[model samples]
Target: MTGTLEIRGLGRNFGGLKALEDISVTLAPGEILGVIGPNGAGKTTLFNTISGVFRPSAGTVSLDGRIISRMRPDQIARLGVGRTFQSTTVFPETTVRETLERARSFLTAHSPMAWLGSFGQRAAGHSVDRVLKRIGLDGMADSEAISLAYGFQKILGIGMALVQRPRLLLMDEPAAGLNSSEKIEVTNLIRGIRDEYGIGILLVEHDMKMVMGLCDRVQVISYGRHVAIGTPEEVRTNSDVIDAYLGKDHELA
Candidate 1:
């Protein structure tokens, strides 16, 4: 079944500092939701809470109607949640195929032994082929990951996630370091994943053009508070959103 993802009253603290406080949001099947805010506005903290990298000091996280807040990172991942980091996390020494092959171990099994057997690599080979085709990297399967262009490496990150066949993908700035044209290409590929693969996407981006063009809904946070949530047209005109991004130039709206 296509799953539902929900975050309710999620909170996180770093001793004296509260990184995220009382945050809540939901994502439906095949929806692309964008989260945007200024630096230290708690964007990544929210993602960390959802991905089980940090347990909330309070509140719950659910997927497909099941409470998963207490699950470990791997457990949460196995439940069909995939996440990409703000910085690329590829193995610089491995080939493109090998990188995906490593991801397959987690995607295909629930036990560590399953990852140790010969079948892991065999199954990984098949999964890698499928993801390569999906991400348009089939021809470069044997190329060293360190040797690919920066944009292609980013695409490889997406391809690695695709190999897992996750129901929900948490993407943090997929277009962070690309040129204008490259950003457009990445945007189209992300849209394809939602439309063609039926995966729900939670996109955290600073690029307004990409967010405005690609997201079905945009959620804006300021000072760790959700200041606005609406369609691109609606948020574009929101005063709080304006002040956060454009300050006095907000009158341009």
Candidate 2:
């Protein structure tokens, strides 16, 4: 069942550098929340903390009221949280089926061969097929994931996360490095995830159009702190947000 992801007063430090300080947001089940900010705004740090890649220096992260700040990444994933990174690289010669199989296998405590002995293996196979079809990759299941086009490779990353059947999905830049058509495809897919599967989504993306149009609510952060949180319209017009994130060109110096 879907549950809330609560990050209260979340803080992270790199020795003396504060990456995130007092960052907070409550992502209710089935809601899509956007975390957008300019360069060096701690967006990645917050995601790393929530996904258990980094432990918070202070505050708490909870799912269904259970504290999860100190949990391992694999452990957190099994608790109905799945994440896709900013980039994806499939193993050479590995088919799409194999890629997803590995991701799903991570949630189970059994070896893949051992898992096949259980009655659940049939169900697992079905899940793999279902995900491939859902992501529009069914026809290419036997094809190498590395052989797919760049857009499909990115979508495959999302499918890898989906086979886990997560209640909440952490997506990093879902629309990054895509052509216009691919961008539209990803936008629809993200919406379908929320409306069809009822999964809460937390995404960090630089694509303002996609984020502003798709998210139920938007959260803006800067310099390790949350600057604003509100509906799309509210966030678009917020002076602080415009000045802090949207107004600034984050190109490398």
Judged by lDDT against the true structure, how good is candidate 2? Answer: 0.87
lDDT of each: 0.84, 0.87
CA shift at 224, candidate 2, in angstroms?
0.9
lDDT of 1 at 34: 95
Tell me how many residue pairs clash in candidate 2: 0
How many pairs of residues in model 1 come into backbone collision? Answer: 0
Best prediction by TM-score: 2
Error of 2 at 105 (Å): 1.0
What TM-scores do the predictions have?
0.90, 0.93
| Per-residue lDDT over 180-253 for candidate 1, one digit per residue giving the tens place of the 0 to 100 score | 88898899999988988888899999888889899999988866777889998998888878888646543321
* Range of the 10 consecutive residues with the lowest summed lDDT in candidate 1: 244-253
